[model samples]
Target: MGSRRRTPYGPGNPGASLTVHPLEGCRGIRAAGEVGLATHTIWEGVLEQAVREGEDVYYLELSEVTFVDVAGAGALAAAAGRLGAGRRLVVRRPPPALRRTLEAFWPGLPAIEVTM
Candidate 1:
């Protein structure tokens, strides 16, 4: 297992960081912390990397994710849309905020599947 990287968000609060770590026994990663303007880029990069790595199915465990802003939600939606044929982006146990954000902003997105 790899170590967790702390990615700081926003300009002023350098102390506030997001923890991103690789998921064990799966072709994906888990993110814990706030997903905002400063941290959304990290999410996009991770998503693209997962796609590039040829993972037929990508998983993102967002149960520990504290918050999701508009840009963060967009990033997730875009990542889901980028999957190729027979590929999927499974979101496992997403937090209520993330679920509600997806439901309110992007209803009926075929690529993103939410499981309990």
Candidate 2:
């Protein structure tokens, strides 16, 4: 186990925030509001820590995410790739912007699994 340092995106803001929730033997994160460069930077670090501490399966619930820039999408894809085979980084309920970004720039990244 490694240290999980709290970032700005971690349970700080009430308006736009990212929270980590524990799933059944796995870890999950929910993101809200705009996922641009600043927030994405914090989010990327949080996701990296989650992946480092989580089990084989990790979940990123993006249902409340309103917007995601290219960097944010790239961060997501990077995390997915870092997980490698036999591990899963499932993205749930991705917004249209994120979906389009992934389809356009990262069409061949099989590690990123988007659902609903």
Candidate 3:
């Protein structure tokens, strides 16, 4: 498994950061840190990688993520939308607001499954 890290500068928010690590024994990733305006690009890159993997079930283990903004959740939904039929993205332990944003804006999306 490989590891990547991105720390984007945010005005008055030096802690804005994101790290993506490939999941062992699976075609997926485990991400940590905050996903907001500053870290969106890295977040999207991680999602893009997941899509490129073309696995039937892509897992996003985000239990360690401190926060995820609405746009970040939107990006996740958009990435899941790109998957082929019968393919899905499993989102594990996301932030509460991020989960709500996904549920509110993209209810019943077939390609995304949220789990605690």
Candidate 4:
């Protein structure tokens, strides 16, 4: 098992940090941010990395995310569609806004997993 680093979230963190940890052939994407237009660059890079590595299951840990926008949701959909064959995208936790967006756009795409 890996240890979780103590990183503060919000304006103080500026979402400057993201850890891509691979476990049991699965990728863990831990992000701390609002994940909006301003931080889309980093989010984009993260998505690219997840795709490039062809993670079997992209476990996006967004429990720390306080907010997310439509662009970000779109990115998730695009990334999920572009993932390697048989690989799926799993979003462990999403803000209400993002969740609603997912329910609207990807209502039946089981590839995008939403957790309570």
**TM-score for each model:** 0.81, 0.73, 0.89, 0.75
Residue-wise C-alpha lDDT for candidate 4, range 1-116, written one tens digit per residue:
22133334433345434333443445666666566655666677777777887657778888777777788889988888887668887787777888999989878775677886
Model 3: CA > 4 A from native: 1-13
Q: Summarize candidate 1's per-residue lDDT along 39-67 as a digit string, tens digits.
A: 66677777787677777788888888767
Cα-lDDT of candidate 1: 0.75
Weakest ten-residue segment in model 1 by summed lDDT: 1-10
* Model 4 / residue 65 / CA error / Å: 0.3
The lDDT of each candidate is 0.75, 0.68, 0.84, 0.70
Order of models, best lDDT first: 3, 1, 4, 2
- Residue 73, candidate 1: how far off, in angstroms? 0.7
| Residue 65 miss distance in model 3 (angstroms) | 0.4
lDDT of 3 by residue, 1-116 (tens): 34444454652246677788888887788988888877888889888887888889999999988888888888999999899999999999998888898889999999999999
For each candidate, C-alpha RMSD in Å? 2.9, 5.1, 2.2, 5.0
At residue 44, give the lDDT of candidate 4: 74
Task: Kindly report which residue stretches of model 2 are placed more than 4 angstroms away from their true locations once superposed.
Answer: 1-26
Which candidate, 2 or 4, would have the higher lDDT against the true structure? 4
Which candidate wins on lDDT?
A: 3
